[model samples]
Target: MSGPVYFVSGIDTGIGKTFATGYLAKLWSEHGKKVITQKLIQTGNVDISEDIQQHREIMGMGWFPEDMTKLTMPEIFTYPASPHLATKIDAREIDFQKIADATLQLAEKYDVVLLEGAGGLMVPLTTELLTIDYIAQKKFPVILVSSGRLGSINHTLLSLEALKIRGLPLYALAYNLNDESQDAIISKDTSEYLKTYLAQNFPNAQWIDIPVVQHKDPLMD
Candidate 1:
C-alpha cells in the first residue's frame, strides 16, 4: 500500500487525538482510500481498545475489511496510566522492538496509516522511550492535536517546540473533546487564536479547527 503514515499525538491527554485520528481515517476512507488506524498502546479500557473502538464507531461500517483492532494496537493494558506505569501495573514490560516491528508491519498493509500515540508527546512509551521517540524513530509526519481550551497556548507551544527540536513535520488540529454540555471553562476563541499564532510564529506549521462532535453524533449513529 501507499505510504502516508501520520503519527498522531496531543499536547496533552483528552485533547481529541483519538477522535481526530478517527475523523481523518473516515475522511480518507470517504475518498476511496484504504485507511487504517494504529494506536501503539491503549490503556484504561479493560475489555476493548477504546481509541480504536471510537475510531471504528465514527468511521461507521465496512471501512475495515477484517478485525483491525488486533493489527493496529498490539499492546494494551487495563491500567489507566502511562505505558510504563500501566505495564508495571500489569506486571509486564513494553518491548520496544516488538512495538517497532508491529508498526512497520502495519505500514506495509494500508494506503494510509493513522498512528495515534497515548497521552502526550512526552508520555513514556517505556522507561526510556517517550512518545516522541517513537515518532522520531519512525519518521512519520506528526499530527499534533490540541485542546482548544484555556491555557492551550502554553501547552501547544511547548509541544511545537519539542517537535521543532526533533525536526518533525507537524499538522496541528485544535478541538474540544468530551462533554461540552456542561458550562466549562473553555476558550471559544482558542482555536482561531492558535491558528493565527502558529501562522505568525511557525508559518510553515498547519493548524486546523475540527468541529466539536456532540455526545451522540447523528452521522455516526
Candidate 2:
C-alpha cells in the first residue's frame, strides 16, 4: 500500500515552513516511522535544492538515496520567485506529471512523505493554478506552518478559510516557536486565539509545536 503524503505550507513566506517540515520529519523518524521529505517545487536555485539540504541537516541524516536521484526535488527554477513567475522568467512550464510521479515513487518506499510547498497556500504555481489547487487535486492532507508573530491571526485564519472552502483535510497546524513575536503578550495571545479558533473550526486537526533549534550541517563550514 502507498503511504500518505502531507503537504507542508505556511501562512506566509519566511514563516518557518522549512524548519517545521524538517522538525516533523526528524520527530517522526525518532518515533520509528520511515519518513522522507520532498520539495514540491524549489525556486532560486540550480542543480541543488537548498531547502532539501536544510531538511537533511535538521533531520541529521544527511542525504537519502531518493534525494541523490532527484526524486525528492522534482522541479527547480532559477529565479527566486513564485513558481508562476519563475517559470515565466525561465520560459518553461512546470511538469505536473513529473512531480506526481516523483511523489508516487517516494510514497512507495516511505511511511510518510512531507511535501513542502514554495510559499503560502494562495501562491500561484501557474497562471491557471494555485498551490492550494494542486493540493486539492492530489488530495494530500495539509500541515500548515504558522507562528505567533504579529498579524499571524489574520493570515492563519485566511489560510484556514481557503482550505475550508475547498473542503481540504487539515492534518495539523504546525506552530513554529522560532518565529514568534518579540512581544510576549502578542505571542501568547496569538497562540491562545489560534488554538481556540482551531478547536472551533478544525476540531480534529493536531497542533504541533516546532521548537527552536540551531541546525548545523556537519559537512558544511
Model 2 earns a TM-score of 0.96
Expressed as tens digits, the lDDT of each residue in 35-115 for candidate 1 is: 888777888777557778788887885435424546676777989999989998999887667666666666787788888
Per-model TM values vs. the true structure: 0.85, 0.96
Please give the CA lDDT of all the candidate structures. 0.74, 0.93
Residue 151 lDDT in candidate 2: 98
* The 10-residue segment with the lowest total lDDT in model 1: 174-183
Off by over 4 Å in 1: 62-69, 174-188, 216-221
TM-score of 1: 0.85
Q: Tell me which residue pairs clash in candidate 1.
A: none
Which model scores highest in lDDT?
2
Q: Best-fitting candidate, measured by TM-score?
A: 2
